[model samples]
Target: MRKSHAFLLYLALSGLCFCGLLAHGLFKKQADVEHLEAKCRLARTLQLTDMCLFTEASYTRHLSQADLHTAFQDYPMSLDHFPSGAIVPPPEIVRRTNGKVD
Candidate 1:
Protein backbone atom coordinates (compact mmCIF):
# COMPACT_ATOMS: atom_id res chain seq x y z
CA MET A 1 0.00 0.00 0.00
CA ARG A 2 2.92 2.40 0.75
CA LYS A 3 4.56 1.66 -2.57
CA SER A 4 1.28 2.35 -4.40
CA HIS A 5 0.92 5.69 -2.59
CA ALA A 6 4.46 6.77 -3.50
CA PHE A 7 3.89 5.87 -7.12
CA LEU A 8 0.67 7.88 -7.17
CA LEU A 9 2.44 10.89 -5.67
CA TYR A 10 5.21 10.75 -8.28
CA LEU A 11 2.66 10.50 -11.08
CA ALA A 12 0.77 13.55 -9.77
CA LEU A 13 3.96 15.64 -9.48
CA SER A 14 5.09 14.67 -12.97
CA GLY A 15 1.70 15.59 -14.41
CA LEU A 16 1.82 19.02 -12.73
CA CYS A 17 5.32 19.68 -14.05
CA PHE A 18 4.24 18.74 -17.57
CA CYS A 19 1.25 21.08 -17.30
CA GLY A 20 3.52 23.97 -16.20
CA LEU A 21 5.85 23.39 -19.13
CA LEU A 22 2.93 23.27 -21.58
CA ALA A 23 1.53 26.54 -20.21
CA HIS A 24 4.92 28.25 -20.52
CA GLY A 25 5.31 27.10 -24.13
CA LEU A 26 1.82 28.38 -25.04
CA PHE A 27 2.54 31.76 -23.46
CA LYS A 28 5.79 32.07 -25.38
CA LYS A 29 4.04 31.25 -28.65
CA GLN A 30 1.41 33.94 -27.95
CA ALA A 31 4.10 36.53 -27.33
CA ASP A 32 5.87 35.59 -30.58
CA VAL A 33 2.61 35.94 -32.55
CA GLU A 34 2.03 39.42 -31.08
CA HIS A 35 5.56 40.49 -32.01
CA LEU A 36 5.14 39.27 -35.60
CA GLU A 37 1.80 41.09 -35.88
CA ALA A 38 3.39 44.35 -34.77
CA LYS A 39 6.17 43.93 -37.34
CA CYS A 40 3.59 43.27 -40.10
CA ARG A 41 1.68 46.44 -39.19
CA LEU A 42 4.89 48.50 -39.32
CA ALA A 43 5.83 47.02 -42.71
CA ARG A 44 2.37 47.87 -44.12
CA THR A 45 2.66 51.47 -42.93
CA LEU A 46 6.11 51.80 -44.54
CA GLN A 47 4.79 50.42 -47.84
CA LEU A 48 1.96 52.98 -47.86
CA THR A 49 4.43 55.83 -47.24
CA ASP A 50 6.70 54.57 -50.05
CA MET A 51 3.72 54.39 -52.45
CA CYS A 52 2.81 58.01 -51.64
CA LEU A 53 6.38 59.20 -52.30
CA PHE A 54 6.48 57.35 -55.63
CA THR A 55 3.22 59.02 -56.74
CA GLU A 56 4.51 62.47 -55.79
CA ALA A 57 7.80 61.88 -57.64
CA SER A 58 5.91 60.79 -60.79
CA TYR A 59 3.88 64.03 -60.83
CA THR A 60 6.96 66.19 -60.21
CA ARG A 61 8.87 64.53 -63.08
CA HIS A 62 5.96 65.08 -65.49
CA LEU A 63 5.74 68.81 -64.61
CA SER A 64 9.53 69.24 -64.90
CA GLN A 65 9.57 67.63 -68.36
CA ALA A 66 6.81 69.94 -69.59
CA ASP A 67 8.64 73.03 -68.27
CA LEU A 68 11.93 71.92 -69.87
CA HIS A 69 10.27 71.45 -73.27
CA THR A 70 8.71 74.95 -73.07
CA ALA A 71 12.02 76.49 -72.07
CA PHE A 72 13.89 74.74 -74.91
CA GLN A 73 11.41 76.13 -77.47
CA ASP A 74 11.68 79.69 -76.10
CA TYR A 75 15.49 79.83 -75.60
CA PRO A 76 17.37 77.27 -77.66
CA MET A 77 20.82 78.70 -76.92
CA SER A 78 20.81 78.47 -73.07
CA LEU A 79 23.33 76.13 -71.43
CA ASP A 80 23.45 74.70 -67.87
CA HIS A 81 26.76 74.37 -65.98
CA PHE A 82 27.82 71.79 -63.32
CA PRO A 83 29.98 73.00 -60.43
CA SER A 84 33.44 71.30 -60.43
CA GLY A 85 34.00 71.48 -56.66
CA ALA A 86 31.26 68.94 -55.80
CA ILE A 87 33.28 65.85 -56.74
CA VAL A 88 34.25 63.46 -53.92
CA PRO A 89 36.18 60.17 -53.73
CA PRO A 90 34.41 56.90 -52.88
CA PRO A 91 35.30 55.11 -49.64
CA GLU A 92 37.60 52.05 -49.68
CA ILE A 93 36.26 48.66 -48.58
CA VAL A 94 37.80 46.71 -45.65
CA ARG A 95 37.46 42.94 -45.28
CA ARG A 96 36.64 41.18 -42.03
CA THR A 97 36.90 37.60 -40.69
CA ASN A 98 35.15 36.10 -37.65
CA GLY A 99 33.69 39.50 -36.62
CA LYS A 100 37.16 41.16 -36.65
CA VAL A 101 38.39 43.58 -39.32
CA ASP A 102 42.01 43.24 -40.46
Candidate 2:
Protein backbone atom coordinates (compact mmCIF):
# COMPACT_ATOMS: atom_id res chain seq x y z
CA MET A 1 0.00 0.00 0.00
CA ARG A 2 2.87 2.36 0.85
CA LYS A 3 4.54 1.60 -2.49
CA SER A 4 1.27 2.31 -4.33
CA HIS A 5 0.93 5.64 -2.49
CA ALA A 6 4.50 6.62 -3.51
CA PHE A 7 3.83 5.66 -7.13
CA LEU A 8 0.67 7.75 -7.20
CA LEU A 9 2.51 10.72 -5.75
CA TYR A 10 5.24 10.42 -8.35
CA LEU A 11 2.70 10.20 -11.12
CA ALA A 12 0.86 13.26 -9.85
CA LEU A 13 4.09 15.25 -9.77
CA SER A 14 4.99 14.17 -13.29
CA GLY A 15 1.55 15.18 -14.55
CA LEU A 16 1.89 18.60 -12.94
CA CYS A 17 5.26 19.11 -14.58
CA PHE A 18 3.82 18.11 -17.94
CA CYS A 19 0.98 20.56 -17.48
CA GLY A 20 3.44 23.34 -16.66
CA LEU A 21 5.42 22.66 -19.82
CA LEU A 22 2.26 22.67 -21.93
CA ALA A 23 1.13 25.94 -20.43
CA HIS A 24 4.50 27.49 -21.12
CA GLY A 25 4.33 26.38 -24.72
CA LEU A 26 0.85 27.85 -25.15
CA PHE A 27 1.97 31.15 -23.68
CA LYS A 28 4.96 31.21 -25.97
CA LYS A 29 2.80 30.53 -29.02
CA GLN A 30 0.37 33.27 -28.06
CA ALA A 31 3.22 35.74 -27.64
CA ASP A 32 4.61 34.85 -31.04
CA VAL A 33 1.23 35.41 -32.70
CA GLU A 34 0.87 38.74 -31.01
CA HIS A 35 4.32 39.76 -32.11
CA LEU A 36 3.58 38.79 -35.70
CA GLU A 37 0.30 40.67 -35.68
CA ALA A 38 2.06 43.80 -34.48
CA LYS A 39 4.62 43.42 -37.21
CA CYS A 40 1.88 43.00 -39.82
CA ARG A 41 0.17 46.15 -38.63
CA LEU A 42 3.44 48.03 -38.91
CA ALA A 43 4.00 46.68 -42.40
CA ARG A 44 0.56 47.78 -43.57
CA THR A 45 1.04 51.24 -42.11
CA LEU A 46 4.41 51.56 -43.81
CA GLN A 47 3.29 50.02 -47.13
CA LEU A 48 5.72 47.16 -46.62
CA THR A 49 5.46 43.55 -47.77
CA ASP A 50 4.11 40.68 -45.68
CA MET A 51 7.64 39.35 -45.34
CA CYS A 52 7.98 42.13 -42.81
CA LEU A 53 5.51 40.29 -40.58
CA PHE A 54 7.95 37.58 -39.49
CA THR A 55 10.79 38.26 -37.12
CA GLU A 56 13.93 36.19 -36.83
CA ALA A 57 15.33 35.86 -33.36
CA SER A 58 18.78 35.32 -34.79
CA TYR A 59 18.63 38.55 -36.79
CA THR A 60 15.93 40.98 -35.78
CA ARG A 61 15.64 43.97 -38.08
CA HIS A 62 13.34 46.80 -39.05
CA LEU A 63 11.89 46.35 -42.54
CA SER A 64 12.30 48.70 -45.47
CA GLN A 65 11.69 48.49 -49.23
CA ALA A 66 15.39 48.48 -49.99
CA ASP A 67 15.99 45.87 -47.29
CA LEU A 68 13.32 43.60 -48.79
CA HIS A 69 14.85 43.92 -52.22
CA THR A 70 18.27 43.10 -50.86
CA ALA A 71 16.97 40.08 -48.96
CA PHE A 72 15.18 38.69 -52.04
CA GLN A 73 18.30 39.14 -54.09
CA ASP A 74 20.38 37.37 -51.45
CA TYR A 75 17.97 34.47 -50.82
CA PRO A 76 18.93 32.53 -53.95
CA MET A 77 22.60 32.55 -53.05
CA SER A 78 22.13 31.86 -49.35
CA LEU A 79 21.90 28.52 -47.58
CA ASP A 80 18.89 29.13 -45.30
CA HIS A 81 19.21 32.92 -45.49
CA PHE A 82 21.54 32.87 -42.52
CA PRO A 83 23.12 36.22 -43.54
CA SER A 84 26.66 34.91 -43.68
CA GLY A 85 27.64 34.08 -47.21
CA ALA A 86 27.97 35.12 -50.88
CA ILE A 87 27.48 38.86 -50.92
CA VAL A 88 24.71 40.17 -53.21
CA PRO A 89 25.89 42.30 -56.09
CA PRO A 90 24.48 45.78 -56.34
CA PRO A 91 21.26 46.19 -58.32
CA GLU A 92 21.39 47.63 -61.82
CA ILE A 93 18.52 50.08 -61.84
CA VAL A 94 17.37 51.52 -65.16
CA ARG A 95 14.46 53.67 -64.07
CA ARG A 96 13.80 56.01 -66.97
CA THR A 97 12.45 55.84 -70.54
CA ASN A 98 15.96 56.76 -71.57
CA GLY A 99 17.33 53.85 -69.43
CA LYS A 100 19.10 56.15 -67.03
CA VAL A 101 20.03 54.75 -63.62
CA ASP A 102 21.75 57.96 -62.61
Find the 10 residues in a row with the least total lDDT in model 2: 89-98
On TM-score, the candidate that comes out on top is 2
How would you encode candidate 2's per-residue C-alpha lDDT over 19-41 as one tens digit per residue?
Answer: 99999999999889979899888
TM-score of each: 0.34, 0.35
Give the whole-model CA lDDT for all candidates, comma-separated. 0.48, 0.55
- How well does candidate 1 score on lDDT at residue 73? 36
Q: Per-prediction count of colliding residue pairs?
A: 0, 0
Clashing residue pairs, candidate 2? none
lDDT score at residue 20, model 2, on the 0-100 scale:
100
Off by over 4 Å in 2: 37-102
Best by lDDT: 2
